[model samples]
Target: MKFSDIIGHEEVRNEFDGLIKIGKISHAHIICGEDGSGKSFIARELAAKILGKTEIKDYADLIEWKINSGKKSISVDQVRSIIEEVNKKPYEGDKKVIIIHDADYITIQGQNALLKTIEEPPRGVFILLLCETMGRLLDTIRSRCQLHKIKKLPKEEMLAFINRKYGVLEDKEIKSILAFSVGVPGKVEDFMENTALKSIRDEVMDTLVSIKNMDYDNIVKCAQKLTEYKELWREVIECFAVYVRDSLIYKETGKEELIINSDKLEDVKKLAMQFSMNRLNRIFDILNFAKSNMESNVSVELTYGTMLFKIQEV
Candidate 1:
């Protein structure tokens, strides 16, 4: 994809284009961002431009590395192999490009093995590292690369992009997706393609409503059901958090337009009446904790159980 095809980050696109035009590209670069925030896409686009190819995979000079299936970390052997390949002359293009997807997955040993190559590659070698965050990488490795952070698009830009790419959606539907997507196009696309996501969102709302009066057995069942969606726990918690925030907004202002979940006005109204502002804030905190814990590989059932119990208490 061309730079213009990217939805947002115009400044970043322009900077990369300018660098390419000046022929002053760096030897090693890190493209860091949240998952689904378009780091990989931008890396591929920049690589294609650098190699003068329409597609990155079609360019013979490109060497890509990622964590192998069922593998937790990228082994040192993998990094060494890329180092060996980059030491050779380019096959087709003037510069050989190495892309390491999920660079955070590279173990300390692996990063050490690749450190020299990144610091002083062959004359015509360039490397791109894509990662969710720089915290997992070594300071030495990070210090060697020029870092660029990718951020989510603005609300208006993201809305326009979804409308242009997909068919027009209702304003409320668009807002609903945007609220959960946090302006990430990949997330918006996934919510659009997977009808089940909407269903799960509805289930989250239902569970929230039920938690107000649920007995211990029912609470256990609800937590168990949520565990079944462990892979989507992040999105689920985000959706619930938004719902709680919207409920508070509606309660404080009595303005339906001010809330994100406009389509769920009735539910919002019911929840606003049932919950005080302080309680809503507490519930939001609980949901946020669950989301954070999920990132740390916490037990899904226990996390949900704790959140449900805390919300019930609130």
Candidate 2:
């Protein structure tokens, strides 16, 4: 996608263009943000401009235009291979661009191997690095590259983007999805693409309601079923968090805009009634904690079971 096509981050695009115009483009740039926050998109946009490929569709041609191009994960060999490409004269234009998506995944050895090239890249060699966590990068690498922090898009902007691209969604439903998106347009788009996410959302709400009513056996059964798809639990936790958060907002504002579960408000209301605000707040914290633990390689079954038992208490 071109910089103009990105839905949010106008200022960032402007600043990036300014750097390019002023001939102050750093040899390497680090674009940092949470997952699905458009880090990789921005990298490719810059790469396209540097490489003189104007049309978004032309990005696919990169694979054939060069000896080799297209998306490739960061690896030690990949980093080493870039040196050979950069050393050559630019073929398409004055600039040769290389994008290392998920740069945080680059091994320390890869970063060290890349140090010399980044320190003094060949003429017109632009390196773009996309990562969810800046802390994962080496300090030497961080010091050498320009850093850009991409925050979540505003809720209204995200909603408009989803609506503009996907056609009509109920205003209320769009707003709910926007709330759940948490400022990440990519994640927002993912929700649109994955129809199963909706079903999982419904099931999570059902399971939460079951918990509030002290349906112990049912909650256990639901948790067991959830353990079957370990990858989904993170999504489920985020969806559930947004679902309850919006209910609290609805309770305060009495506006449809304040609710994220327009299609399932009855279940939301039921659970909101059964738990105190203090307890709901704790549940949100626990959900976030559980998500963190799950990512840290904690046993999914034990993690989810403990989470379920606590939800049942509520």
On residues 269-314, what C-alpha lDDT tens digit does candidate 1 reach at each position?
8889889999998888888888888888889999999889989998
Question: Which candidate achieves the best lDDT against the true structure?
Answer: 1
Q: By how many angstroms RMSD does model 2 differ from the true structure?
A: 3.9
lDDT of 2 by residue, 1-314 (tens): 54567778777777887887887878889889988887766777777766666745454313211112554346677776766766777666667777766778777888898888888987777877778898889999999999999988887787678877888878766755665677888777777787767677777777777775656677667877778767777787887788778667666666775565666777767776777788888888888888988988898878887788886675
Q: What's the lDDT for candidate 2?
A: 0.74
Q: What residue runs in model 2 are displaced by over 4 Å at the alpha carbon?
A: 1-3, 57-73, 172-176, 247-256, 262-270
TM-scores of all predicted structures: 0.87, 0.82
Misplaced by over 4 Å in model 1 are: 54-57, 245-258, 265-281, 292-298
lDDT of 1 at 289: 87
Residue pairs in collision within model 1: none
User: Whole-model lDDT for model 1 versus the true structure?
Assistant: 0.85
